[model samples]
Target: MSDWLHNLPVPMMALVIFGFTYFLAALVFVAVALAATEERAKSLKAISPGMLPVLGIIFGLFVAFTAAQVWGDSDRAGAAVSREASALRSAVLLAAGLPAEQETKLRGLVRDYVGQAVAEEWPMMAHQEASLKATPPALADALKLVVTMMPQGRAQETSQREIVAALEQALDARRQRIIVSLASVNSVKWWCLYLQALCELLVIGFVHCDNRLGSAIAMGLFATGVATSVLLIAAHDRPFTGQISISPEPLRQIMPEAPTGHS
Candidate 1:
């Protein structure tokens, strides 16, 4: 089912699903309204046709809000990844301040970590799991050595403090990247999409009752609108999947020689 849904030309699929569902809903609503009118013919029933316009306005607003949220989420994910890559690069450069051997080891660790994320974590992001692990023990060990090398004077204390600060920043960046990547899936957005879909169906149904030709046109319009919205939301929601997904280009550029392993 998932594959089938994913395989459809997104725009067309969205239209077909929304149009059929809404048309059915309109039929049911018209039937009920007609039944009620028949039951109270002597009471002079007056239907408020204005409600349709109001519904359309509400639907438009809801769709706009969802689109904004999806776009925001996509932007945030991209920014977070970029920030992480920058932090990693900065950390690698700072490692040069350490003793020669320690610097080489730290740089290697950073390269390995970036490589693992690109090769492993990236591919599995769509699946919501990261299997490859590039341990930070090597980096930690280098930091420990740097701290020990500090002399008993004020300069040593100051240098040690700087090293600690850089390490902390790198670790924080790494944590942020992981958290943001994991949170790429916005379930609440999905629910909102579902509600918007329901409302769209209701609107289509209302049109169906007023005029058959008009209803068909409305269905076409509604289908196209809803499908476009869903496609936009899905593209952003799974920012790591599909052709429009965010690329790990920054990581690639940073660790050119790093091993490509799962995570």
Candidate 2:
């Protein structure tokens, strides 16, 4: 699936997939039907219908394998965002254990990080342009501030340790999300899926070549299934790129009032 198709709205996406699939099916029906002579029709009818079930099974497996990766990426992307948000919230709470001035500064740093993530990093991730080379400055500063501060008491010492841990977790979660954002169904798998589907379509044409009406009906129904399966999988193939993408709302929820520049 191309980025242009994935980026389309759901209804438009469906129309394109369904329309293209039906067109291909019609072409197959016409080619087979017109080419079938009386003697050839007898041979075509003799072609085992049993092969149809086998081809259908193979096509189903292709869809299953492809869909598994797509759905898994979506699930992982969601989990990573949620974990990052949870870690940031924990750090904010732990910041309270510091002195008023230090705690305020620490909270401010967290806000800045979240704000930048929502405004800048998100768009980059959407296009798979985000890189690990770009370490978030705010998080780096917060880590520095927390690690350098001398704990005045047991409570402060605990807060310092926990806040550091929280920040680390947040960083890890961010890394996970960015890595998952880069995941997509590779071209080889896509080719395999389509080729298998084409094989099935050809088998439908072969087995029903003697009867144009039966051929048309079988191809239409199968094409619809193939198109719908493909549309559903392709829409989510690149978890971060599509209209069904994971949003930065989890990060935004951390500091709704934080000043954000451009998304």
Candidate 3:
């Protein structure tokens, strides 16, 4: 769940998860096989195969529950970014209603804000370091200008009010994305998930203790399933931190010709 692991490309991430699961399966098999004496085999055989289905069900439930949260976070992150871009686009269009000088300044402000978001805020979001403790300065200045600017007619007056509304929408969208960026699977849930998996692996070993070949094959298949489930969840767990994260292209499109370097 570390950033290093999440940032790996999909194929490499799959390899790591599969390899770890296989190794753990092998370890459990070796331990159980070593202790499988003739009398122990009899007792081990008594461990009902019915428990296999029961344990498997419990493990599946854990994976399903965890996956739901991860998928939700990803969806929310994408929506927030899209909504922010749309609001900024509205502001840029509405600026045309103002005097030529004021319109130019408002457009420049939007450009500055998008550039900062791409070059500065993005990396911070990826690392879960973007905080809402301070307002974005470019957006703040735009809001102040819209509120205080003198309008000569109904057209400019309506534009000013709508621009303020658009800026507020963009601000709310920014807050949503930052909050979603901070989301991740907590340690307690991870601990529970792994512990459940280990229990299932142990049960498999007990059920097939007398036959090493059978034990290995069954565990290997189950391990593959476990690995696949884990990989799917982990790849999308931290929406902004991973290779498959939501992009800033929507924001960049608002001011396509502007440079994206931090000032």
What is the total number of backbone clashes in candidate 3?
A: 0
Candidate achieving the largest TM-score:
3
> Which stretch of 10 consecutive residues in model 3 shows the poorest summed lDDT?
254-263
Lowest summed lDDT across 10 adjacent residues in model 2 is found at 254-263
Q: Clash pairs of candidate 3? A: none
Q: TM-scores for all candidates?
A: 0.70, 0.94, 0.96
lDDT of 1 by residue, 21-95 (tens): 556545645553464344543332244446556766776777687777657766776876777677666666665
| RMSD (Å) per prediction | 5.9, 3.4, 3.0
Q: Which model scores highest in lDDT?
A: 3
Worst 10 residues of 1 by lDDT: 36-45
Count clashes in each candidate, considering only residues at least 3 apart in sequence or on different chains. 4, 0, 0
- Model 3 over residues 116-143: C-alpha lDDT tens digits? 9999999999989999999999999999
Off by over 4 Å in 1: 1-46, 130-163, 184-210, 256-263
Off by over 4 Å in 2: 256-263
lDDT of 1: 0.59
The order of the candidates by TM-score, greatest first, is 3, 2, 1
Deviation from native of the Cα of residue 64 in model 2, angstroms: 0.8
